[model samples]
Target chain A: AKSVSISVEGMTCSSCVQSIEQHLGKMNGIHNIKVSLEDKNAVVIYDSKLQTPVTLQEAICDMGFDATLAD
Target chain B: LQKHEFFVDMTCEGCSNAVTRVLHRLGGVNFDIDLPNKKVYIDSEHNVDTLLETLKKTGKNASYLGEKSAQ
Candidate 1:
C-alpha cells in the first residue's frame, strides 16, 4: 500500500468531510483514509498498482472539493 | 470569529456523526461538515479553544488549522 497526504480546500463542515470520505471509500484498492479538518488535508492509504495519486485527486475534485497532493 | 481547521482521526459515518453532535452542542452553526475530509467549518460566537476541547473529549485529536478573519 502506498501512503499519500493531500491538502483539500473549501471544506467547511463535518458533513463535507463525510462526503469526501464516502466517495473515496467507494473506490477500489483504497485501504484507509484519515482526514484533518484543522489541517485542511487528508492522508490516504491505497494500492499503487490499483490506483494512482492523480486518480485520487480526480476523485476528490469530483466531489466538489479542491484537492492537491501534499508536498 | 475565526475559521480553524482541525486534523482528526475518524474512520466511519458513526465517527462523523459523533463529531457533529458534539460540535452542535457547542452552539455554532456548522457552515460545512465533510466527513470524508475530516473537516468542519463553523461560524460561532464562541471561543475556538472550547470547541477544540470538546472534540478531544470525544476521543478525537483536533488542532487549530488557522482562522479566516471576519470582514
Candidate 2:
C-alpha cells in the first residue's frame, strides 16, 4: 500500500469531511482515508496497483472540491 | 427569521445534498441550494458567522452574497 496527501479546496463543514470519507471509502483500492477540515487535505492509503494519485485527485474534484497532490 | 444569500463553491448534487443535510440538521435553518448558480439562500435565526461556520463543516468555501428581505 502507498500513501498520498492531497490538498483540497472548497470544503466547508463536518458533513463535507464525512461526505468525502464516505465517497472515497467506497472506492476500490483505498485502504484508509483521513480528511481534515482544519488541514484542508486528505491522506489516503491505497494499493497503488489499483489506483493512482491522479485518480484520487479527480475523484475529489468530481465531488465539487478542487484537489491536487500535496507534494 | 432572516434570509441570507451566499456563494458556495459546490460542484454537484452530492455537494448540495451535503450542504442541505448539514444545515437542516442544525435546526431552525432552511436552505435552497442552486446548483448551477453555485448559490444558496438560507432562512435562519442564526447569525451569518454561525451559518458560515456550519457551512465550513462541509469543506466547501462559502462567501456571503448580501442579505435579501426577510421571509
Candidate 3:
C-alpha cells in the first residue's frame, strides 16, 4: 500500500471530518484515512493499483469538499 | 428521468448540505455532487431553470451545465 496526503478547504467541526472520512472510506482500495479538521488535510493509505490521487480527490469531491494533492 | 447538471462553488460539507437541502425542497429530485469539479447532477422531472434558481438561493454561485432526459 502507498500513502498520500491531500490539502482540503472549508472543513469545519468534527462532523465535517467524519463526513469526509466516512464517504472516502466507502471507496474500494482505501485502506486507511486520517482527516484533520484543524489542519484542513487528509492522509490516506491505499492500494496503489486500485486508486490514484485523482480518484482520491474525486471521492473528497463526492462528499462536497474541495480537495487537492498536498504539495 | 431527466439528468441535470450544474457547476456550484462549494468549499465544505456545510455548503454541500445546503445544496442537498435545497434540492430536497425541490421535490422529486435526487442529486450527486462533485465538489472538486464544482458540479451537481440531479435526476428529476423538474426543468433546468428551477434547479438553477434553487441552487442560487443557497447563496453559492451556480451555473447550469445542460440536461439530458432518459427515454
- Model 3: runs farther than 4 Å from truth? B1-71
Name the candidate that leads on TM-score: 3
Candidate 1's C-alpha runs over 4 A off are: B1-71
| lDDT (Cα, tens digit) per residue for candidate 1, span A1-71 | 99999898766667667666776877899999887778998889999998999998867754445689866
Best by lDDT: 2
Better-scoring candidate (DockQ), 1 or 3: 3
lDDT of each residue in A1-71, candidate 3, tens digit only:
99999988767767667767776787799999999988889999999899998899866754556678866
> Per-candidate TM vs. native?
0.50, 0.54, 0.55
Runs with alpha carbons beyond 4 Å of true place in candidate 2: B1-71
Query: Could you give the CAPRI-style class of model 1?
Result: incorrect
- By the lDDT metric, which is better: model 1 or model 3? 3
Tens digit per residue, CA lDDT, model 2, A1-71: 99999998767677778878987888899999999989999999999999999999987765557789966
* Residue B43 C-alpha lDDT in model 3: 86
Ranking by lDDT: 2, 3, 1
lDDT per residue for candidate 2 within B13-49, as digits (tens), equals 6578667766876779877888899998898889999
B38: Cα error in model 2, Å: 13
**Could you give candidate 3's per-residue lDDT for residues B13-69 as a string of tens digits?**
677775786677668988898877888988877878887887775555799878757
DockQ of 3: 0.11
Worst 10 residues of 3 chain A by lDDT: A58-67
DockQ (CA atoms), all models: 0.03, 0.07, 0.11
- Of the candidates numbered 1 and 2, which has the greater lDDT value? 2
